[model samples]
Target: MTGARFWDMVCTALYLALYAALYAREIPVPAKRRSVTMSDVAAHAGVSIKTVSNVINNWPYVTEETRQKVVAAIEAVGYRPNHTARSLVTGKTKAVGVLVPDVSNPFFGTAIRACEEALVEDGYSLFLCNTNEDAERERYYLEQLLSRGVDGLILWGARLSCDELEGIVGADTALITVELGEEPRRSNHTCINVDNKGGACMATEHLLREGHRRIGHLAGPLDRITSRQRKQGYEQALVTAGLEPLPEMTVAGHPSVQGGFRAAERLMRTQKPDAIFCYNDLMALGALLAARYLGLRIPHDLALVGFDDIDVSSIVEPPLTTVRIPQAKLGRLTGKVVLERLRGSEGSERVILCPVELRVRGSSGNSFGEEQKKATLDALISSFSDGGERPA
Candidate 1:
């Protein structure tokens, strides 16, 4: 063989050996680093870029054959569309912001879970924020969420004023209030709320019917609408029952366990109330603990009732007989309203007043040692005229 020919053959052999060694070593070559793009998928699928876009957006214009081809190509090439780029082009984030006072509270937790489920069904994401019942924090979170370009906002606290809320409501962005009253200025925003006054009245009347005339109320901060409405209801019930609403029978504090404990301690020291109605179950639990510290027997020495029949209420030593609010339903309704607004539904902001029921357990009883469980149960059942069972 010729020397040049031999040299060429040797070079070829060496090149082949190097290739085999590399292959055996399994050393991955640096790829071109091409980003997954719509054009790439469209080219692979033998379709137009618009057709690929249509399939990705679930647009109805694309034919089944074309959509199937595009989907197959996308899967084969691992072509995932950039959601951020799509959102930028469409100017729609497809996200909703939910702001609540306290995420730890069972009522808020249940509401958030329901809202998440409803939004999930509609192919939307949720950004949850907890304000911890701080008005300043609520406003800051609202501004931050809005600035993040969420399509809609669901507010569950009474921190925003009418003027402040007006700045947030507009055509592009929708607003919904959960467990709060309607904004007087912007009647266009939707709201889902409970009849706070009515529920408080029902609870107070239950104690009254059980022959507890000198009932005291553990009130929340008067600045909040729920607290004000509940206080009104408690007073109204007393007036209706021919009992004078005395100032000394009410104690105001934060809607917290510590607040409840302090209020109950003060009430007990000044004038021991035969029965006590707390603003919420947390407060009621605190009052119960305070009563125990005082060596008082529940229902026999001091009857108690609370609101927001949270999960812990049923697990306490003596199960709490409180007012039950449909927390999950409230959340689902809030999500639905926000979605409707997003769809460009126009009308007066809907004000949904969900009903509340009294849950009678072993907490409230009569002086004769007879548990008012049957009467409370009957009342709760009768309150639900639609025949739906109360939340267990």
Candidate 2:
């Protein structure tokens, strides 16, 4: 698409997003002095009401100049669509249900914002709901939204059981789940998740290439699928580097800052490691704080890296070398998939894997550029030869 068309779509989506969010928050709409209608817009633009309808519906035959005129009149009068009437005619509520585990997490926050924008552009509003990581809460919201006549659902949490989730898919509700570790075994539901294992492997390998033979991992609970995959990837990277996988090197946590802090402190006192890779940014932050409390200088004494390049990752002391997940793109893709199912144009999008990359920073004490890698490898050889300290 051309740049102009891209921006037009974005602006349109954002305008609808603002209104949808306000409605969900229970804010009262401002009453207009005079009710604005298609007729009013038509009169203002000096076109017939049918012409105005064509512009609103994006009819291909309408001239570009005519569409611009109607759009301008729409802004001037601040007219909103009569979605109730439209739904009555089309059998679609023109609204979508959204479930998120934690909006406070920057990863979820960015994805939710993007999903809302993309859905709104296609004339679908969102019923925003936060589940707070409770499987029962997620199921309750799922039922509630479905009962309320939402056209589709975009969910970010997977605490619900396979049977419970299959019930929704059985109804053909046009659902898409984000960050699910495993794909749902249903024809109606689609799953989109980042390459968690691949990204974790990248983070661990980066540290290994930096000459840190003794690297530790601050991991999430093994019960969770995502955490298990990440830990597996970390171990795989060690084996690939020809290092024996040490069972004591993995310290499990809750994927939170406090979890990371306690885990790091415990590891420091028992198993000494030259560097640490956390499952996420929040955990890495906790580890960073723990390192300070132990009076160990970062990079010089303990190198650090984290997953999920959250907003704070770049602003933290010495910044963080981490994995960057394209959260917004994930959201946009989910939005598109849900829409397609609702429209009957597609089925079973299956699994969509988004790409991730490493962001080199001062926390690693060594960037992974070509020259730096060569120098670091040389240093690694020297450190092993005579047991000398490795150069950063």
The candidate that achieves the highest lDDT relative to the unseen native structure = 1
Q: Compared with the true structure, what per-residue lDDT tens digits does model 1 show for residues 13-103?
A: 9999998987767776798887888888988999889888989888988889988999999998899878678889999888999888878
Compared with the true structure, what per-residue lDDT tens digits does model 2 show for residues 223-271? 6667878888899999999998798988998777888999999888789
Which pairs in model 2 have colliding backbones?
A: none
Per-residue lDDT of 388 in model 2: 29
Candidate 1 overall lDDT versus native: 0.83
TM-score leader = 1
Name the lDDT of candidate 2: 0.81
lDDT of 2 at 281: 91
Please list the residue runs of candidate 2 whose C-alpha ends up more than 4 Å from where it truly belongs after superposition. Answer: 1-79, 242-244, 366-392
Q: Lowest summed-lDDT stretch of 10 residues in model 1?
A: 366-375
